[model samples]
Target chain A: MENLIDIKGVRHAYDTAAGKLPVLDGLEVSVKEGGFCAVVGPSGCGKSTLTRLIAGLMHPDEGEVWLHGEQVKGPRSTVGMAFQNPVLLEWRTILQNVMLPLEIVPGGLKGKAAVERAESLLALVGLEGFEDKRPSELSGGMRQRASLCRALVHQPDVLILDEPFGALDAFTREDLWQTMHEVKAKEPFTAVLITHDLRESIFLGDQVVVLSGRPARTQYVMEITRDGPPKLDDLYTPEASERLATLRHQIEIAQGRAEEGVSA
Target chain B: MTGTLRKILVPTAAMIIFLILWEALVWVMGWPNYKMASPSDLIPAYERYWELFLIMGWQTLWRTVLGLLLAIIVGTAIGMIMGFSRTMRDALYPLLVGFNAIPKATVVPIVALMFVGAHDFNTVLIAFMISFFPIAVSVSIGLSTLEPEYRDILRSLGASQTTIFWKIALPKTLPEFFGALKVSVTLAFIGTNLMEIVSPHGRGLGALFDSGKTNSDYPLMFAVLIALALLGIVLYYVVVALEKVFAGWAERQPG
Candidate 1:
């Protein structure tokens, strides 16, 4: 597999009223084509900023962000994103909201084709009857599902999930994780999921990258080895327990609670 | 009752009760019509001067509508410009606030003097000036406070500024826009009436009120006031109707 996204020594800072606040420092990450990269870190570790850099919504003050072997110079229509809030337009129906990117991106789907594409994605997400429903009409979980459809509707080269399921209850989050696998199996695309939940990261990601505290840098990378697709029951196994413990320890180290080469 | 019916019926019932209370008060006091004209007393005035009332009311209505339309165009343009750029907003906001702080009544005389004898134009001008501030302010707030997430979603898709404005910003701002319009329409009527009262253009309900005041015709004066209130109510409902059509999504309740 070829590398679809490569972030090399990416550094960024925000110029606040107080002064410049560094967010990302010497961060490095890469995701092969059709691979899922879950990035976990401490709170305010600049995970969201990393998503923006990948989406080309903003540029790093230093270093490079490459997508498909090309350095990102500006916003790219080939990137799709979903945030934790699932900010669907109140003015559009679920289907129409899903089709929003198609309406904006040049040479994208139009008219009946756009509607069909949106409708199909909705059906895939089990939102078939919700086509004409407004975003507010749906439950939080349903709305998030619709948002995922919206993000993928344009067939973007890269999909970025910026804590998209952070607001959901545990049950809803797990269901979405399974739905995510189902969707990815059908519609292939490289993805970067920024999450706080260790289980979520291990379940959804092939490669999990951990970052240190504020002004974050990649601290550790763990690749999950599974004989078959991930299942909820697998999370209760000893192997899964060991991986979770190790990741939890890594997070403590990242948060500066424990030093490197120390056992808890 | 259905929500829509209740919305209309409640206000209608309340108005009827209010009018009955006023009539009872007048009858109990036994004041002369010149001192206080009840709703019944205004009926004879309406019958006698029906044609005059029609012409004047039409004049006031048209002027208010015309001025409000112009205000919408100019206010939306200014608001969008201010919303899109921090420099423009910073440069223009303080000036707008200062101008809006001035009494529009005082400005009426200045406008009447500048365009002397252009009574209709002066009325429209004052209406536009008085009503545009709320619109510009509301629109600017709506745009500036737009959820950055929505913008990020569109921008990542390489959406142009114009496309974002039309698809997201404009639709999202509609609830606020209509809210401002509800306020602006009333202000427009006040502006038109203010010009008519201050400068006595002899063509609107305000002028009718002035003539009735000078002649001590209390019933006619009351009739003009009623006419203006009715017009305002009608225009208000029109805006509410438009709000339903354009931004109905904002009013939805969770299922």
Candidate 2:
């Protein structure tokens, strides 16, 4: 399979009033075309920063980021992202919100055609006939779905979700996990997801990369090799329990090491 | 009192008792008719003044409307530009702050004089000066207050700058628009009145007030004062109603 994205030995640091501080140390990750990769880590493991680097929102201080084998310099229009917050525009109706990306792209496709594409995307997310309601009127789950539609409306090649369902109720979050799977199953796109939930990582990911804490480094990149995605019932099975235990053990060791460093 | 009576009837009876006491005070005090006009006297004034007030109010309304329209156009455009770029904001904000600090009332006479007594222009300038700052500041604040997440989401989607402005920035903060308009509309009326007073020739409530002050006809002065107060109340509520229509989305949002 052709690699859609390749991050080669990337390093990032922040220059603050306190002085220089490294966040990512020689970070390396890759994803093939039509792949859905989840990155899971302990808190402050620089997971979110990795997504920013992948999307080219910020430049890696060292090494290179490649999308489709080209150097990542700035933002690529072919990339879509959803954050923890839905971040919908209060004044716009649901349909108009979805159409936003279509209008924002350069030399944008316009008129009836663009609107129709937007409508189709919204319907795909099960938001049909709700194009006119404002974001504030929608439930958190619905608003997040609308945000997803807005991200996908432009037909981006890459999708990045940074804990997209973090703010939702568990029931709603589970519902969205299935909805996301349905979208991916139908029309596959290269994806990078950063999440804290073990179940979410196992359910949606082809591969999950675990990270070390503070001046974080990749500890392990675990490949979830189930023949097909396991259902919610699988969350408590022996096999699932084994994987979950291993992941928790790695994170706990990383946390213990970081606490010793602070004490030192 | 029953269920409805416990709430509505008590308030209603209280209000009626208050009004009756007021009426009885006037009757017992034998106040001069002109000094303290009764409901009966005021009712006739309402009937006689309604048509003439409408005509005169229309003239003032147009002046105020034109001035406010200009402010919205110029202010929103400048504000959007400034808010979109930090460089523009840094360059222009000091000048705007300086202008904002200038007492607008002091400029009205000069503006009126400079325009060679064009009453409409004077009113427009007054409205522009009084209302422009709030509209510009409000629009800039609204534009800048956008969540970084919303902006980042757009960037990831490869949204064009124009679309971001139109869809996200404009619609997301309509409550601010209505808020700016409410404040500016009041300033619009004030601007028209200022110009009317300075020019001393235009036909508006301000001109009527001027003539009343000049002639020492206290009744006419009282009449003009009453009319102006009613006009202010009407203008205020009109903006409030418009805000309700435009900012329904804002109401749904959590504070």
Candidate 3:
């Protein structure tokens, strides 16, 4: 598989009033074309920063980020993003909010074409009739679904999700995972998901990358050998449980919460 | 009562109770009409001097409206500049604070001096001066509150600053703009009234009060007060209605 997205020796730091705070150090990642890569790390591992770097929203303090064989100098129209919070404009209806990118991206869809694209995307997320409703009127799950539609509306080459369903209940989160899987399967874009949920990472990602603590580097990378997208029932299987336990143990040691050489 | 009916009835009942208490206090105190007039005296006064009140009240209301309209344009432009540029904010914020500190009433007299014989211009200037600061400050604050996440999302989509301003910043500032308008509209009325009170040309509500005070016609003075109060209430409600129409998204809908 060809590398669709690549982050090479990237380092990022924030200049706080106190001092310079380093977040990512020599962090390298690569995703193959049409791959869904879920990045899992301990909380505060600068996972969000990585997403920003990939999306080209900001420049890295050092090193290079490449998308589709070109260096990412600035924000690209071919990159789509959804955050943990829906961040829907309160005044816009669901359909309008989903269509926001089309209006912003240069030479993007417009007028009736934009509306039709938004309508079909909404339908994919099971938000068909809720098009005219304000975000406040929608449930938390519904809002996240709408947000996903917004991110995908412009049909970008790479989709970056920063814990997109982190605020939802467990049930809703799982349901959205299935929705996301279906969307990716149908649309076939390279996806990079930053999440704290390990189970979610394995469930949705073809490849999972884990990062260590602050000033994070890639600690471990796992490729699931599953034949197809895992169903909800697969999560309850013994094989899934063993994989979960192994990942949890690795994360505990990586976060410095457990001794590396000791058995619990 | 239904929710809609209760909303209307509750405020109406409160107003009725307030009036009854005011009447009782007047009767018990036995304060002459000059000091305190009951609703009985107030209603008859309105009927007898309806023409005077209407003509003068119209003059005051139009001046207030004109002044407020000018303030909205000037203030919002200044606000957008201040909001978009850090240097502008740093340069102008202290100056605005200092200008707002000076009593607007005192400026009225200075404006009168500058204009000399132009009473209406002086009145409008005073009104503009009085209401400008609040609108500018509110709009600037609203623009500043554009969320980091929103910026990130828009930037990721390759949105330019101009697009962000029209699509994001402008709509977000509307609720704050309307809030400032409500406060500034009242200030505008005060500005118009201040000019009318001090000016020799007494053609508005302020002039009615000035003449009534000179002649010791307490009923006429009280009548003017009622008209001013009604004018303020109506204008405030108009702003409230406009806010509901334009920025209804900011309001909390009942479940």
Candidate 1, residue A247: the lDDT equals 95
Model 2 chain A: ten consecutive residues of lowest lDDT: A255-264
Models sorted by DockQ, best on top: 1, 3, 2
C-alpha displacement of A123 in model 1, angstroms? 1.3
Chain B TM, every candidate: 0.95, 0.80, 0.95
Q: What's each prediction's TM-score? A: 0.97, 0.82, 0.92
Candidate of highest DockQ = 1
lDDT of 1 by residue, A100-139 (tens): 9998888999999999999999999899999999988899
In terms of TM-score, the best-performing candidate is 1
Which regions of candidate 3 deviate over 4 angstroms?
Answer: A258-264, B1-21, B43-49, B86-94
Worst 10 residues of 1 chain A by lDDT: A224-233
Using Cα atoms, each model's DockQ against the true complex is: 0.86, 0.56, 0.80
Counting only residues 3 or more apart in sequence or on different chains, how many pairs clash (N, Cα, C under 3 Å) in candidate 1?
Answer: 0
Off by over 4 Å in 2: A15-21, A42-45, A104-133, A253-264, B1-59, B86-118, B198-203, B233-255
Candidate 2 residue lDDT tens string, B14-129: 86786578667767888765555444344555565567567777778778778888998989988898888889999989999998888777888788678876777677778777
Clashing pairs in 1: none
Model 1 ranges with Cα > 4 A deviation: B1-11, B253-255
How do the residues B67-147 of candidate 1 rate in per-residue lDDT, one tens digit apiece?
A: 999999999999998998999999999999999999998898899889899999999999999999989999999999988
